[model samples]
Target: MTVVSHREDRVQAARSQSSPARSRSRTGSWRPASGHVFVSGYVVLLALFGLVPALYSLYLAFTDASGKFSGVKNFTRSAKDYRFIPAVQHVAVYLVLWLVTLTIFVVLLALVVHRLTSRRTKAVLRFVYYVPGALAGASSVLLWLFVLDPAVSPVSKLLRWTGNDNFAQVIVPNHLPAVFTIIAFWTGAGGWIVVLYGALNTIPTELMEAARVDGANAVQTALRIQLPMLRKWIAYMLILSLAAGTQLFVEPQLVSQASFGIVGNDYSVNQLAYQYAFSQNDFNGSAAISIDLLIVALICAGFFVARGRLFETD
Candidate 1:
């Protein structure tokens, strides 16, 4: 009896000692992990903001003008829409210009700004470059309006110098691709410069010195060492820029508005979607067009995701 009692007492003591630890693991560790609440909140917000709208849009895309299930009719109609192909082509042209300019010029400009000046001057120039990007959205559009207005623009002399006698010449249909490219570069390249410049900074000074010792000139070092190091950032920029370029709404819409539809009746797929949903009240058509854009963006994003090793650092 004494032995049994001793064993039971020991068992009880072990259970008692372990209970608090179990409780702590269950309730304490879960009290809050770092970023747990933030991540959870983001998930909730995404559900509310992203998932719900997507589901609703999906539902709408398959429905008719009468809110009845019309199968793929809406999508077919969207494909056959008069403005559809033109909108797609417009967006394609804009993206080509915007993405190419951003990729080449942002990197080149960052390299130039980083190498050509003292630290103070470089910092000042970076601030100036970043200002337009900081003022993106409606404000940037308004600013570009001033810049492109041949009457009062600081570049009026240059525009006249280039034989762009009026705003019409500045934003003609054939020249729109170039014009939007210039505007996009002006507003968008700044943020990217900041990113590339920061990436350049992360390149160890030792690497540059080693390149010098190996008789690599500035151009060679930038092209070989610096450029190679910037590959990941450039790829990331490509993916994001492609996605953003695909959604070419704000610039086109505002410019169209500013130009009083002389720019176009429809400038992009996104504009078509917006007009369908908001103006024409053809929600199904809008959803269908939006799905097309979503697919294109997903393809670009998928490439980025597939090349995951680009993001890794030793």
Candidate 2:
């Protein structure tokens, strides 16, 4: 009986030690498998929707109507189109205006929101900010058309005061850059403000407190401490904004239709590409326009990634 009891004790001790090892192994194995499952799905989607289309665009850009490689002919052909330079100029002006507005206002609003001590107030304000962004792009643009028109708009007095007594006057070509910038900002900046506010939350409270202890005022602290920490977030916003701005299709296209071609069919690079493909039946030219925009986007993204040290660990 004594011998049997001792053997049972030894077995129990061994089981206790091995159980933890088995649990650890199970945990480690499950984690990697779960991670792989999530990542594999994303990778598959990106390859299918993002990578494949880009590669096909590249092929189309370099090939002729006969599917033979035509070198840079398609590129030069698109560039020589009469409307090309104007579209480029319009896009340039809009980008410059929109990017500058986004940088200043988004960051400023975010800083103001972050300064609020009441959690409920912050939550409500964040929701309010994001509400405009919830509207579809076309819907937002259409909504703004009414707002910009003095005839049927609630802000008719304000529109008239600005010398835009009619929709035509409001949407004139010279005013289109500012008009587009306002539309883009109204729909886009809200979401970015919410994003920047969230980024501000990720900053450690201890650092903020330390800054306060050193007699740093709100403006000083934001400029010296918080803004510096938010460099990467701002860079990311700029990169994405630049990409979306360069592909400015929906606003100008819809506006052109609404204004009876006052804004023109080729008001943006993407619109020019659309006109090339469907209107002119020039697929290679359309692809070349798309490739040009893609190259610009890639270069801007690379610049931000490098200058912002986006991947570096804190």
Candidate 3:
């Protein structure tokens, strides 16, 4: 009876020791269906809204007015339009100005905000930065029109200082790129600043402390540690900004209408596409133009992803 009791005690101890290991292994291996359930809605929405439209547009781009496969005829036709190249050029110039300004300023502002030690100050500043993002889309553009109007604008003197004595002068073809850049930055930069600031907060305090111990100054720490850590976030910002810049429609379109054709109907590729579809009744040409923009966006995204190693788990 004593020998049997000793064997049972040993077996029970063994089971107790192995039970935790078994539980941990099961926990690690047992991925729940919840993740798939959560993602299903997004996948459905994407398919319904994004995939469907993109596929239809792709089909339209390759077909003629009569619905027969026309190869690249629609693309060639859109390219041959007099307004196409110039619209593309305008969008290109605006994108360059907008992207450079956005990158420099958003990163700088985010860094500055992140350096604030007081939680209240950080929160207040973040709220202030995000305030402009609330006025997005057409309303933001209209608000800018009012702000840029030298005649009644509160910054009229500043505009006068820059030789822009009226809204017309402010939005002149020669200055439209800068004007659009400013508007875009005002409406867009705030959100990105908040995003980057949040990303900066994710950096471990221990790493920062180590940097300090190693005699790295603020600038060195930022450049070497923080910025490198933020590579994926910055890449995401640039990709989205590039995509938005290529679309360049609402602001220029509203400015054109407000300025009574001064900005022209075909100020950007999207506007040109709109003209093709509505004014010229050329859906194929419009789809072709859209495909061009889509290609540019995809190429830009690919470049950023490659350079930033965005998909790498490490």
The model with the greatest TM-score is 3
RMSD of 2: 4.2
* lDDT minimum window of 10 residues, candidate 2: 23-32
lDDT of 3 at 259: 90
Candidate 2 local lDDT, residue 36: 88
Compose the digit string of candidate 1's lDDT tens values, residues 79-111. Answer: 998999999999898888888778888999999
Error of 2 at 151 (Å): 0.3
Using lDDT as the yardstick, the better of models 1 and 2 is 2
lDDT of 2 by residue, 60-133 (tens): 99999999999999999999999999999999999999999999999999999999999999999989988888
Compute the lDDT for candidate 3: 0.91
Candidate 3 worst ten-residue window by lDDT: 23-32
Over 4 Å off in model 1, which ranges?
1-32, 66-68, 305-314
Model 3: how far residue 110 lies from native, Å: 1.0
